[model samples]
Target: MDALFILTMLVVICALAFDFINGFHDTANAIATSVSTKALKPRHAIILAGVMNFAGAMTFTGVAKTITTDIIDPTKLEAGSLFILAALLAAIAWNLITWYYGIPSSSSHAIIGAIAGAGITAAGFGALKAEGFIKILKALIISPLLAFVIGFILYSIFKVVFKNFNLTKTNRNFRFIQIATAALQSFTHGTNDAQKAMGIITMALIAANYQQSTDIQLWVQVSCALAMGLGTSVGGWRIIKTVGGKIMKIRPVNGVAADLTGAAVIFGASYIHLPVSTTHVISSSILGVGSAHRLKGVKWGTAQRMVITWFITLPISGTLAAIIYYILNLFF
Candidate 1:
């Protein structure tokens, strides 16, 4: 293979690696509530999440197409092996840092931010699409609020409907429902998250002249999904504990409500080809559920910390990617 071919292969591998980490890091988003409420054991939840995540990837290509063609100008990116390597490394590094700290950071934002930073460093600000960035910004801003409202309203309705029922009976009933909700959440997760990797891989392929259009191929979708599913199976235990157990004590009813609300928001976003953060959705749903009971039930400190992380993720990851690209340019 030529040097360009090898570098392209490396970029695909690294992009998939990021997808795996995306799954591994964010497993807590899908199964955390089910696991916390004892609706599903951790092992079983991970297995189920992994399978559905894989299955979800087979469904669509619109989001992938958007990422590859609309987000950044392909012509402006340096068509060099080292540039790709640096961008991937920057994403991976940011992923690891947040994962280690057990922060529910946005992997989607991290990767996009890294690409933007690397692209700007290589080709200047003109390389990015302002409209595409605005779309992403809108998703980031709107998704959590959507999730919160849905979760709050759904939980409130549940409370009202079950007002006369025994609490134990309600919990038992919702435990069964949580199984379905968890599955739906996993499906949405796959649809949204897997497409991101597909987008990156498709971009790499376009750069390498392996295809004619920026559309994602079926194989790319399958591979990205499978990689993410496998990553979910391995699980991010630290984050799992943080989200599932530590945030608030989840019961079956609240868990089901949170999962359903999150699934709905994510599914809506996916249908619109908007890449929203599953982490933000789930966390906001959890907060909504907690606050539905009373403000005191939600842990303000933790929520504040998570919000701070959310605020910092884009800039921090972007700066990191820019620095990494600068350094790699020295040697490559």
Candidate 2:
């Protein structure tokens, strides 16, 4: 054995671990509304989400390529393997912390910030590809806002069109519709979130001189999909509680609206090969629906707390990763 081989193995294990954790951490968001509205039972929803996530993960590689090259070139940094490992560790740690506390934080922010932190630590601030990094940052910031707007408008239209319909019958029909929307949201989540791990793995390969291009290999894609699917089987109950109920008292109609909005925004991002936070997008869509339903019905306290977490995640994770990289440098 070679040292590089061991290091690359560590990167793969950690990246997969991050993806697995992401499945449990964020998959809850995708199905929260459906579960809350009783559109799907919890057990059935998890099974459906797991299968859909795996299928979605297998379907796309564009976002994975962006991750491989966008943040900072792994080959250009000194001790690049350690840098990626630190980023993964920091991201995993932040995700677990938020998940335990039932706060829906952005795994996208955590990983992106960690990569920047580790890269700066390894090669100073000069190593960043300014244009590409800013492009990703813009996507993360804008997508959730778009979700919010779309959710609000779509639900308002729903209100006008369905005003005269029978409430009980309409709710029943929407409940069935939620089943489809929930699966779509979960599939879109898989398309985006699973690719982050694939990107990390590809970066490791490039760093170790195992490959030259940002092309995602077939094994990388499948392994990431499996990891995410297996992790989705272990549902995040705390998140389900927070997202499904705390933001607003969701009816089946509202759940369907939010699910559609989230799915559309996330899938659109994937189509353009940009990474956005599924957590942020889903939650924002719910908030939008809540606002449209009844401004007074929305829980501002929970919304405030989540927003605070979103704003601080990047700086905190970055600082954490930088410290981890420094400590790892000593032992390696």
Candidate 3:
């Protein structure tokens, strides 16, 4: 077999693996609140999320394009396959580590940082497209903060609008409404997160001379969607526990607000072809809602830990990717 062919296959397999892990790892982002609030049974919520996520993945390719060309040009990098493989390994490691710990870290941050680290290590600072990389970084940083503000404002509005209603009746009504919002949030997650793997696979194709245009092939899209959907079926119970309950005692009204904010922010990023952290956005939305509900009700300790993970993930993943690239280059 041709060496490039073997490496390309490896990239595809690893990329899909990353996508699979992403699905289970971030599944909590979509269905956590609904499950916590008893708005949807856990089994039903996962089923809904899996189907909606697949549908959402099939609907967009713009973010895939960004992942293909923005951070580093696959065509220009030296030993590009090794670079991508190292990135996948590093990202997958970070993801599994965080998921095991039940930490709501950013998968978006992990993959992006790993790619950047590997690229720079393989080809130096010049390998990066400063303009596009910076743009992506900004989106990652800003979106969660934006979600915080949006969630805060939306919940505030909800409080005033429903303040006159009977509490029990309102909670009962919002529990039903949360079902729809949870599905929307999951769909939005598919629109953005699944594309990361698609982008990685497309970049591998380009680097290995198996493909030309940055346009995502039909096979790539379907495969990524299936990988994510299948992974979603497995469910990440640890994450569900952390995000659904640890962040705050999620009420139906709070869940609805957070779901709306997360969906809006993720979909907005997808439309613009920017990748943002769904984990960060969803968690922040919940935090925002908690703050709105009552300042003290939000568990500051758990939120603080998650925030610390977000800040550290990028640099650590990048460094790991760089080290992994160096080691892989020794063999491949």
lDDT of 3: 0.95
List, residue by residue over 185-219, the lDDT tens digit for candidate 1.
99989988888889888887877778868767878
Per-residue lDDT tens digits for candidate 2, residues 105-165, read: 9999999999999889989988788898999999999999999999999999999999999
List the pairs of residues colliding in candidate 2.
none
Clashes of each: 0, 0, 0
Mark the regions of model 2 whose C-alpha exceeds 4 Å error after superposition: none
Off by over 4 Å in 3: none
Give the per-residue lDDT of model 3 (tens digit) for 1-332.
98778888999999999999999999778999999999999999999999999999999999999999999998997588889999999999999999999998999999999999999999999999999999999999999999999999999999999989999999999999999999999999999999999999999999998889999999999999999998998899999999999989998999999999999999999999999999999999999999989999988999999999999999999999999999998888
Q: Enumerate residue pairs that collide in model 3.
A: none
User: Which 10 consecutive residues of model 3 have the lowest summed lDDT?
Assistant: 73-82
**What is model 1's C-alpha RMSD?**
1.3
| Model 2 residue 142 lDDT score | 97
